[model samples]
Every structure is written in structure tokens, then in C-alpha cells.
Target: MRALVFPAILVLVMAVIGHVLTLHLVPSVIMGTAMNRLAAQGAALHSFRLAPRTTPQTQLVVRPSPDLAYSICAYHLRGPQPLRIRAAAYDDYGSISFFDARTNNFATIRIEETAPDSSGPDILLRGPAGGEPDGLFDGHDLKSPTPRGLILIRRLAPTQQAYDRVKAIASADVCALSSSAGTISE
Candidate 1:
């Protein structure tokens, strides 16, 4: 019974450690897998007319337009590696997100905002492998406890026709919303 108890305790301790380690590592594992996927995607995206540049090993900064201030700087979210995407915009609340040229997908995070760190102007677009963008938006253009704005992303529509295609998609979504609202009113 004593020997059994010792082994059981040892097993329990190992299990606890394993769970703790997994919890800490899950985000990394997920990000890595995503990066691998993105790397394959980026290879295809190079054809798009985006000036994809690798996230430089050194940090880069984008100064605000004088005192106008921005909720987010679209450039910082660019990359630690070469990232290819159609067009990117600073959404309503100002989160810099973008569309992937390869997969025409979108992604975002707290890419930047109020009182951000001066350390990194990281990359957001991942390679076929995952990329981590600078998670800071250093400057407050809004009130207290800032909002995490949506970083609207779209595949780079370099031409009029490509733009039209994206525009149509947007119009469709907007139309759907408006139609739903109208029906709800009735």
C-alpha cells in the first residue's frame, strides 16, 4: 500500500505539471501551426502587388501625423517578416489589420493603442508560419480604458476590378444587415 501511494503521488504531480505546461504552451503551438499555414500562403501571395517586407530584426517606428494622433498605426502591424496582402486600412476605431493575398483571409489583434510600449513596431502578417505583430498602439485618441477596435482586413485589390470585387462583397454584407434591420422593424 505504501509503495502504491508513492507511485500514485508521483503520477499526480506529473499530471499537474503537464497540465500547467500545456496551458502555457497552447497559444505558442496554435500560433506556430498558423504560421506554417501562412508560410505556404505567403508564397502564393507574392504575386499580388503588395510591397511585402520581412519584419526587420530591428524595431521600426511610425511617427503620428503631428498632434492629430491615431488609435493605431497601420505600419507597425506590417511584419517581422515579408508579408503580402491586398489592401489594409485603419478601421473605424483604428486597429491595423489586413487581408492575405494568398488566401484572401483576415486577422487582427490589439495591434496598437493608447500609451503603447516604445520597444516594438512588430509585424502582424504571418508567413506560412505564424507572425507576431507588435501588440501596442502607443497613443490615446480616445477615452479611458480604450476599446479594442476591429482591424478591418481585405485582400489587396490593386486594380479597379479587384477593388470592385471586394466592394461587392462589402455591399452584400451591408445590404444583408440593412435588410435584416428593415425586416426586424416590420
Candidate 2:
């Protein structure tokens, strides 16, 4: 009986220490991996520009999902929102990673409506990061300045309120993004 108790106590003590260490250690290990990748990709690349196409701006413009990161070759706004892309992209930012938005290991873009009586993130963009962007524009290979980190036009998604409020800067133009295939020039 004494021998049994000693083994049991040792097991219990070991379990407690393991559990406590894992609580913080496991998370740091997992989160650290992702952070390392983002860093390896390099802090938001800051050397690209969008060239306006002569098209009449009749296409529905969309930005790519940040998780589906890729080289943003070009992005344009024909509507009145004064659309601007605050982004940091890599040289190979044109890679795409589209997956199921509901249940997938990868990131996704979800939609939600804001309440009239409250201020909050109305439309939810369910990625590794969550956001309530008013509008969201997405395309695999878009032409833009910053070519990475889920380039958001800060609420470019289509909805009743967004359509009405930001229609001026809104356009049906679908912006395209992709890798340049050579050394990026300044």
C-alpha cells in the first residue's frame, strides 16, 4: 500500500507540472511559429504601385484575403470613397490560399451586419485575425501598392449600408493582384 501511494503521488505531481507548463508553453510554441512565418515573409513590403487601367471602372472591385496573400499588382477605385490601401506586401505576395470560410484550418472571410443602435464590427472577417470591416473587396491577383497582409480597403465589402454610404468610391471593377516575375523596381 505504501509503495502504491508513492507512485500515485509522483504521477499526480508530475501531471500538475506538465499541465501548468503546457498552458503557456504550448501556446507560445504555436503562436511563435506563425509569427516567425510572417516575419520571414518580411514586415509588410513597402514597394509597389497601382497603375490605373483605362477601363470605364464597370467591374466589381475586390481585394484578396490576407491569408490567401499574393502580390497585389493593381487596385483601383472608381467610386467616391477615396479608396486607399494601407498595406505591406512581400515580393512574392501574389500567392493565393482560398478555403472554406466556415470550417477550415485556413483563414476565411465572414459577413455580419452592424446594429443600428450600437457601434461595433458589423461584418466579421474571420481570419487568423477577426475584424468588422464595413466593406471588403477581394480578388486573387489584384493590382495595388502593398501586396500582402490581406490588403483591406478598410470596408470594401458589399452591403446595403456600405453600398449606400460608400457608393461614391465604390466600383464594380474587380482589382487584380499577382507577382511581378522579376526584381521590383523603385
Candidate 3:
């Protein structure tokens, strides 16, 4: 009985170790691979690119809905300047979500939550190392836990016409660095 107990304990310890390593390492590996793929597809760091409408043949993400338009940005926030993100509010449904290096969603802004009279919401993204931004800015201030991450913007567009319209609006979306003068500049 004593011998059996020791072996069971050993196996349990090994299982626990494996579980911990998988939990810590898998997310980083997956996220890194995704970032690399996006970079290869001409996704510039700190700049927004309107993704082509999701088709089964070109779908990089899992189970992307055909009824939505997507714009993606792979952001690196290690610089001294903080990133500024702005998206045109859709009439119906739209949202921007920020994900950290580990694929953890740190923030999301939905168009429905914007003020009725506002055109859209302005977001300021800063890394953990970045201090409070200089000057007064009317926007949502978001702090990223990591210096590297991705931003995804989705808008509902059921038809080709709607997709084109969403694309036009998304083209005006800003994912750039904030200048010392407190203005966003690509």
C-alpha cells in the first residue's frame, strides 16, 4: 500500500507540472504564431489594414462570420509614444477589441455604448511602461499589460454593399502613435 501511494503521488505531481507548463506556454506560442502569420500577410505594426471579406478559402481565423467586416492591426507598444485608436461608429453593430500577447482580451469598445450624438469613440492605448499621456485628451484611456498585442475591429455587414460601406468607414479608422503635440499621426 505504501509503495502504491508513492507512485500515485509521483504521477499526480508530474501531471500537475505538465498542466502548468501547458497553461503558461501554449497561449504565448499560439499568439506568437498568429502575429507572425499576420505580419506575413502585410499587417504592419501599429497600422490598421482592412481585411478582405472572410471567405472559407482565405479564412485565417477560426469560424469567421461572413456577415462581418474585419480590420486588423498588430500593435507593438514599446515605443515612447502611446497608440491612438479610432473607429467610425456603424449605424447598427460594430466593436473594437484589444488582445494582449497571450491572447487575453484586455478591452473592448462597442458602438452601441457610444454617445448618441458622438461619431465614434476615441481610444488611447499605452503599454505598462508608458506613463500617463501628456495633455488632456477626450477619449478612453486603456493600459496594456504587455508591449505587444493585436487589435481587431468588427462591423456587421450582411451584403456586399454593406461590406463596402464598412470597408470605407474602417479605412478612416486610426491606429497610430500619438505625437508629442497630443495629435494622432501615422
Candidate 4:
């Protein structure tokens, strides 16, 4: 009985250690893999690039969806620069999401949420440490807590025709770093 008790306790300790290690390592591993994939593809910071259509060979991101056209803009806040993303309002459903280096989603906006009369599909992203832009309304901007992150744009494309249309829209999507003169509020 004493021997059995000792072995059981040892097993429990090992399990706990394993669980804690996994908790710490999984997210880092996933984020690192994603960044590596992006680099291999020659993806540049603050530029919108349409992802290749989902295929068996595609492995850049998990769970590639054939029904959705996807684009991504990876950014590094080296200059602590502000980024502006703009897309024309379209009939098809779409969304833009921002993820930090650790894979935390800092912000997301859907097409329906931004009316045609509203900000016109324009969004400003700034570092958390950066001051708010002058004369901009609250909902038009978001702050990223991390220096490095990604902006993902997804559009529903249920058919070949829809795919073509969505692809065009995604291609036209803009992600650019704002000039220093324009980044800060006066």
C-alpha cells in the first residue's frame, strides 16, 4: 500500500508539470510557427497580402476555409507607427481582426458594424503606448498592446463568382503605416 501511494503521488506530480509546461509552450509555439510561415512567404510589414486560396497544400494558417477569401497584413511597431486600413464597403459579408504576437485578438470589426455613412471602412491602429489621434472619433481606432501583430481580413466567397469578386476587394484592401507627421494628435 505504501509503495502504491508513493507511485501515485509521483504520477500526479508529473502530470501537473506536463500540464503547466503545455500551457506555457503551446501558444508560443503556434505564434512562432505563424511568424515563420509569414516570413518564408516574403510578407512585409504594414502591407496587405492576399493569402492563396485554400488548398490541400496550404499550411500558413490553421483551418483554411475554401469558402472565404483571406488577406493578412503583418505589422511591427518599430517606429511605434500608426497603421491605417481601408476597404470599400461591399455587399458581401467580411471582417477584419487584429492579433498580437502572442495571438491575443486585440480588436475586430465587421462590415455590418461599419455603415456606409460611418467611417467608410477605415480603421486606425496604434501602439498601446501611443497617444490617441486628434479629431478622430472613438470607434475609428484601436490600440495594439504588442509591438508586433497581424491584421487579418476575411470575406465570404461561397461560389467561384463570389470568390473572384471578394478576391478583387481583398486585393484592393489597404494597410499602410501612417507618416510621422500624421501619426500624432496636435
TM-score each candidate. 0.33, 0.28, 0.87, 0.79
Cα lDDT, model 1, residue 159? 55
Residues 1-186, candidate 3, lDDT per residue (tens digit)?
Answer: 888998999999999999999999999888999889988998898898888888888787777899988899888888668898888778878999999998899999996678767768888899887778766786788999999999999999889899989877777788898874268776
Supply the TM-score for candidate 2.
Answer: 0.28
Using TM-score as the measure, name the better of candidate 2 and candidate 3.
3
Residue by residue across 1-186, what tens digits does model 1's lDDT show?
887998999999999999999987775455445434444444222222121221233112232122111121121112223232222222222333433322222544332332343321233233342233333422211111111111233243445555444444332111000111112110
Better of 2 and 3 by lDDT: 3
Tens-digit lDDT track of model 4 for 115-137 = 76653377778876666676744
Residue 50 of model 1, lDDT score: 23
Total backbone collisions, model 3: 0
Off by over 4 Å in 4: 1-21, 117-119, 136-139, 180-186
- Candidate 4's displacement at residue 2, Å, is 14
Ranking by lDDT: 3, 4, 1, 2
How much is 47 displaced in model 4, in angstroms?
0.6
| Off by more than 4 A, model 1 | 43-94, 97-186
Question: Residue 113 error for model 4, in Å?
Answer: 3.4
Q: Please tell me which predicted candidate would have the highest lDDT against the true structure.
A: 3
lDDT of 1: 0.31
